[model samples]
Target: MEQNLQYFLIPFLNWEMMLLIWVGVFAGIWVGAIPGLSVTMAASLLISFTFSWDINSALALICGVFVGGVYGGSITAILLNIPGAPAAIATGIEGYPLAQRGEAGKAIGLCTTVSVFASFVGIIVLAVAAPVIANFSLKFAPRDFFLLAVMGILLIGSIGGGDPVKGITAGAIGILISMVGMDPSTGEMRYTFGNIYLMAGISFVTAMIGLFGVSEALTQFRQAGLKSPKQNLDRIIPSWATFVKYLPLSIRSSLLGVFIGALPGTGGDVAALLAYDQAKRSVRNPSRPFGTGAYEGIVAPETANKGAIGGAFIPMLTLGIPGDAVTAIIIGALYIHGLKPGPMLMIETPHLFWMIVSCLSISSIALLVLGLISVKPFAKIIEIPKEIIMPVVIILSVIGTYAIQNSVVDIFYMIGFGIIGYFMRLYGYATGPMVLGLILGPMLDANYRRTMQGAEDQFLPFLQGFVTSPISLFLTLAIVFLVFSQTAVYRRWRGIQ
Candidate 1:
């Protein structure tokens, strides 16, 4: 215990490490607030610059970026209705409305308070329950992952603003688009159409930039006369009563976030969306109607996404499996530093695990202080003229898309997606489901194919695996329950309708 305490205290005692974490958090806020410049991108960039640094300092910076970036995404979502990251999509549903009503300060303040609380929730879970969750996750089969992807696809109902059919259409289109490149497992061209660039497949980041960032820019052009919302900055921190009012919901949503974040190929985006849906269904006496400006809405998603920060680290530290793209990059950093990250990683290098837990805890604390301090400046950005900001936003989108692979083709593709997203939004189709489909499509396809191969391409055997494997059976049942919960009868039973 004393040795573990030493590992945890190392970062707190090192001024250089502490400074890097604070700097990373500050930089991450700006980066994440800019659409298309995602947490994954920031962490990847850190790797290039920090490769020669000691592993501990590098990790401290990355941890700060991870925590701060996740929270920073909400800043734009609340202020401009454009989600800086997919995880913030649900935040915008309520947050942007609050901003429009000139309550951006209160909304953001509450979000920060709950987010910090949830980050601690995730850290505690990581410290206490990580090994158990890691072992349990290891039991998940390929079929189970495929099932999980299917469950994620069903979340279109939650994210889609209206018209389930249109949502399904958009989501299906996204899934199809995800198949545009060569097949990874079979090494065969899919929808590549003989284009060399197509063979590498589309970067989802580029699509996200187009769909959420540039598309939002184009949509704003149509609302030319609309002025940006004025913010109330006097009371940017929540009162104890306000925090207490939402404590229960924060706890529930945050725990859900931690679990979802620990899932491989899943991350804060899914967790936030799920938490939002759960809050919408569960909160009976909301401060306001959900779509307009409900505090419950912001609390659920912000807390969930923040909680996912610690959750993402659990699998990375224990099982070598990345919980999300940011963690995947962190895995590469570990490898570059001559460290293996599998089950033996913790047993052989116990200090690394404890140190990560410590760093994430410190990062969360930094996020609260830095996040609150930036609220006024961030809120002010919302007041910028659309004519000036929109063009800059588009340029940022172009740059962010290009940075993914330094490809000009991706910029064109991003522009094309932006155009499509604009038209779709005009036609009442929400972009959220489509992005969800794109994110989960590859995971679904790869896992399904692997499971099928394991079953020797026999249909019956593939189905049987769901019943044969305990983990697969549990997931299958959960999927069934999820489907059932969507029915009118179930809603009626829960008194939701």
Candidate 2:
């Protein structure tokens, strides 16, 4: 215990390590706020220059970026209708409405506070229960993963807004679009149509930038002359009472995030979406109607994504597996530093594990300070005239899309998606369901196929797998409950509004 304590204090004692963490957090905020400039890219770039630097310094910077980047994604989601990351899509559903009503400051403030708290929750779990959680996460099979995807698909009703038919249609289209590449198992062409670009599959980030960023700009052009809302920056931070009021929901969502983050091939994006859907179903008396500006909507997703930061580290440190994209890059960094990142990692060098906990702890504190300080400035962006801001948004959207692969074709695809999104909005069809479908479609396809292969192509055995395994049975039941909870009978029984 004393040795671990000493290792944890190393970062606190070293000024250079401390400074780099602060700087990384500051840079990460801006990078994450830009569409397509992901935390994974930032961490990967750092690895190039920091190859010869001390492992401790490199890790400090990466940890800071991980925490700050996740929080930064919510900034644009609230102020503009664009989500800087996929995890923030649920935030924009309610946050943009709050921004339009001049409550951007309050919304962002609440987000910052809950996020910091959740980061600590994740850190605590990582420190105390990492081995146990890592073992449990490995228990999930392909069939269980497929069920998880199905649960996510069922959320179309929650995020789809008022028109269920339009939402389902848009979601179906997104799934069809996701099927454009070659099959993972057979290597057979799908919807490529002999196009070289289509064979590699569409990058979801490019599609997201077009669907949310560019589409938002085009939609704003319809109300070009209208005055932007005057933001209320008076009460930026939430009171103790307000925080206490949301304590229960925060705890529930953050824990959920941690567990989901610990799962391989899943990350904060999935955690945030699931948390938002759970909050929507469970919270009976929200601050406002869900789609208009519910505070619960903001709290659930922000906390879950932040908690995922810690959860992601659990499997990475204990096992050799990378929890998410950023952690995958971190694994490469470990290899470069002459350190193996497997079951023997802790036994070989325990200092690395404790130092990471320390780094994430400091990063969370930095986020609280920086996030609150920037809330006023970020809210001011919403007050800018549409004529000036919309054009800039469109320009950024194009640049962000091209940056993904340096392809002109992606830019064209983005603009096309933007136009489609605009028309969908015009026709009262929500774009959220489509984006959700695009994100989960591949997961559904790949995992289902894996499960089928495992059953030797036998229909009876494939169907029996769900009931035969404990993990699969639990997930299957959860999916059933999720569908049943959406019905009028359940809603009435529970007195949910």
Candidate 3:
């Protein structure tokens, strides 16, 4: 395994792979700076153009963008309320608050430092631990996955920009939308309503584009071209002391990121939120309350979100299960190049796996350098006129979504989601629940069916399994907390007592 891992990571010292990685890095950064464009979208878009490329070169470029774009979303989320990607929502909770307070540059600096560092940790863990954990991860059958997805969806409460109802509502909407496509087991159409387009259901990327892109444009217009702070930022870097303070938390979050990323269906957004919640719980003094411009607020999610990059690859390489949507698409790319990802893949494609591991570490280093240099200038972008900024955000969002499949239908999907997202906000509904639900819905469906099948008509084992797993127990408690948070009695009791 040791010797084989090397073969995969260093298959060839070719210029093409290096160039493709660079291209992905650049494209990811650019795409991530805009609202609605996500790492998944960027990876999917690359799939179209790279049908003929060498497998190693394709992996290098695609993975580079995947890592970069996840980090890049924080750039806009910190500078503007318009999150560049869904995973940046948690960042926006603290980030936009800082931006509103005219500390956009400071927030950007802190986030950049953590993001790069966390990514480095995640990559290191992925490289070192893949062989050990890949098989363990596969132990998660459909039932386990379903329970895991439910646990992940519960995270919606914290991610709702501080509201539970809106998030849950949005999540319900997303689940319903995901249900539009044919039932995987039943082979029946539930929500297509005769349109072939609806048969494919609502893609999360399009919904995200609408929720972040269109809603943000309307929001900017509401500001009526309001002037923002004139950021005179230079030497915008986080202090070493700050990095030292977050080192422990960063490591913990990176671990969480890796595990969550390794899980099928869930991704960076979930990892970031989970890390943020853990940070809130673990920090006794907190330096300052989170969401109040605390450095911890910036570091926690930044680290976890980027750490998810490595976590996401673990399952993809060894188990042939795409950890998330982006990896799923990349899996397709791998097969297109005559490579398969599975248990046998380790024996047949060992070199491919190591190359990916190596690329992850290299990318993290690159992000650190690029992130430090770019964060200040990116934050300064808030100074652009709302009229100009809003329109550009919309255009980029449309292009980014459309770029994924070159489909005008996706642009329309984004528009629809935008309108829905605007109303959700107006009505005090959170988009967080919706996004989380959308992400977890398919996982939930697949796993639920599998668990039922495994039970052989007995429900007790299914219930027993839910109660037995350590991860499941912790997740169940989390779900309980989420549901309790929404209770009128809970709100009133707290208010009065």
lDDT leader: 2
Off by over 4 Å in 3: 1-20, 44-56, 161-163, 329-340, 347-350, 456-461, 468-497
Off by over 4 Å in 1: none
- For TM-score, candidate 1 versus 3, the one ahead is 1
Candidates in order have lDDT scores of 0.88, 0.92, 0.75
Please report how far candidate 2 places residue 419 from its true position, in Å.
0.5
Clashing pairs in 1: none
Tens-digit per-residue lDDT, 1-497, candidate 1 = 99999999999999999998998888888788776788998999899999999999999999999888998889888987778788998899899889989899888888888999999999999999998987777777789889888888988877777688899899998899899899989899999889999999887777877888888899999989898877789999999998999999999999999988998878998899889988887787889977789999999999999888888888988889998899999999999999999989989999999989988888888989998988888788778988998898888788877877788999999999899999999999988888888888998999999999999999999999999898889889988887888888887888764
- CA lDDT, candidate 2, residue 210: 86
Residue 199 displacement (Å), model 3: 1.9
**Candidates sorted by TM-score, descending order?**
2, 1, 3
How do the predictions measure up, each by TM-score?
0.95, 0.99, 0.86
Q: How many angstroms is residue 116 displaced in model 2 relative to the true structure, after the best TM-score fit?
A: 0.3
